[model samples]
Target: MLTSFYKMHGLGNDFVILDERMGALPLTPDRIAALAHRRRGIGCDQLVTLHAPTVQGADVLVRFFNPDGSEAGACGNASRCVADLVWRCSGNATPVLQTRAGVLPTSRTPDGLITVDMGAPRTHWQDVPLAMAMDTLHLPLPGDPAAASMGNPHATFFVSDFGMVAQGHALEHDPIFPERANIGFARMDGPHHMRLKVHERGAGMTEACGSGACAAVVNAVRRGLAARTCAVELDGGTLRIVWSEQTDHVLMTGSATTAFEGTVDLAAYPS
Candidate 1:
């Protein structure tokens, strides 16, 4: 059977989105990895799927899979892409998405930017789910990185230079992370501006990472290095991240675009 899919991106972090709301589509880890292979299949940083909402108040259920076929608890960039698709199909500017992390509400600004309410950051050692108990504010590691969870584990290392992309691979699999982590290296351009590069847990280095951007800002704020609201510049584009003090939620605003749409026969891929 052929499955229709949308090719979309948010600041160069691309995805293959399959809407499974109307019908069922078989998706196994091997097939997902096969479909995400750049040389052999439809290339994407992640694969996303939209399904009928299973949670109260959620407009749709969104799932994110890394290129390696690992399921992600949340993906900020893909959430915006999914929100845009949901809006275009339902005419609802604001849509609620349910994921493994929880329910997330999204909105479109008058200027056409998509904003996702990414909920609060989790800073506790157990919450970030570190292997052992330690102060999340100052992890006992080289460069003294900080850790936080935006539904997924993340470790942010602040530096004077933004050339730490090479360190992401080793840091992402550090023994302390247990489940591994998205590694973010941030250089502060100003009190409210930052330059970031992230190595995703399963997808390796990407041009952009929304949740990584959010984690960068939150870590900066926790370290008193930046203001609550910050602008994060990634390789592909920029994202505005605001950690609301009152609501304790992180609001991420960025662009979501459609590259194209097509169909694929899942049976042809590896099972």
Candidate 2:
């Protein structure tokens, strides 16, 4: 059957969204991987699915999947895009999204930006779920990266240069990180600004990573390298991240753009 899909992007971290709110589709890991293939399928950093909310107070249940077909706990950029879609469809200015990580609350900024309250960063070693307990502030790894979970495991390496990014893949699979992790190479530009590049676990390097940026800022703040409110510049664009002292929630603000829309035959892809 022909299924409708929306192509959306947030700071160049793009996704192919399949809306299954009306009904669930037959989707498997293999099918998801096939659709996410850049060369032979609709290209996207990740594939997202929108389902009817199963919990109270949530506008929708959103799921993120990588090109390699693995499910992710959270996706910051994709959340903004999904919030916009729900707000448009339901006329709810503030849309709540439920994911594996937790429920996320979203609102629109005065200047047309989407702001998602991504809850809080988990700094506990058990939360990051390392193979063994250790100090999350400084991992027992090269460059002394800090670890945090923004609904997913993340390790931020504060570097003066990005040359260390070449080791992202290696560190992502390091023994310490049991489930693997998103590796971020961050260069502090100022007290309130920094530049970042992320090697997402399943997706590899993307133009931008919403959760990765949040984790980076949270870790930076813990290290006193950046202010609570920081601006993260990625290869695709920039994002405003604020780690609220009062709420302990990380608010991520950025633009969500619709690239195009199309229909695809799910049956044609591998199951």
Candidate 3:
């Protein structure tokens, strides 16, 4: 079967989006992994699928899959990209999307950037869902990393340099995390600025990571290393994150772009 897909990106973190709102597609783990293979199939950091909303008031249902064929609860960059797609399709500037994490409200900025209200950060150890109970502020780890959940597990290690990309892979599979985690290495440039590199859970180091950026800012604020509202600089671009004091919701602002769109034969890839 031929499947139509839209190729989109948010800050260089690209995705191959399949809209399944009208019809269902055969998407197994093996198929997803095969489709994500750079050389053999359509290459992407992740695959996004749009489905009919299950919840009332939600404009659509969004699902994210990693290159390893693992389903992710939340993805910040993909959220922005989906919001843009929905807006262009339905002409709804403010669209409500339902994900495994929860309902996400998205809006367009005056400057044309997409802003997603990522809800509040989950700070408790059980919320981050560590292997065992421990202080989330300071985990019993070598680098003294902090843990927070932006709908997904994340561990942020504050370092003086941003060259610890290799450490992210090791820490992502660490035993402390019950489920694998998106490991982020952050360096505070100032009270309102930070530099970050994230080794994602299923996908290795990417050009950008939206949820990782939010988790990094939340962790930095908990450590008093950064202000509540700070600019997080990822490899691809910068994202403005504001852990709102009034609403307690994290607002992530960035740009989403359409690279191209095309159709592919599903039978050509193995399931």
Q: In order, how many clashes per candidate?
A: 0, 0, 0
Q: Give the C-alpha miss distance for residue 190 in model 1, angstroms.
A: 1.0
- On a 0 to 100 scale, what is the lDDT of residue 52 in model 2? 85
lDDT of 3 by residue, 1-271 (tens): 9999999999899999999999999998889999999998899999999999999999999999999899999999999999999999889999998999899999999999999999999999889879998999899988899999999999999999866778888888899998989999999999899999999998999989999999999999999999999999999999999999999999999999999999999888877
lDDT: worst 10-residue window of model 3: 161-170
What are the per-residue Cα lDDT tens digits for candidate 1 across 189-240? 8889999999999999999999999999999999999999999999999999
**Cα-based TM-score, every candidate:** 0.98, 0.99, 0.99
The residue pairs in collision within model 3 are none
lDDT agreement with native, every candidate: 0.94, 0.94, 0.94
Candidate 3 regions with alpha-carbon error over 4 angstroms: none
Task: Give the per-residue lDDT of model 2 (tens digit) for 1-271.
Answer: 9999999999999999999988989899999999999988998999999998889999899999988899999999999999988777688889999999999999999998999999989999999978998999999897999999999999999999999987888888899988999999999999899999999998888899999999999999999999999999999999999999999999999999999999999999998
Better-scoring candidate (lDDT), 1 or 3: 1
Q: What's the CA RMSD of model 2 in angstroms?
A: 0.8
| All models, RMSD in angstroms | 0.8, 0.8, 0.8
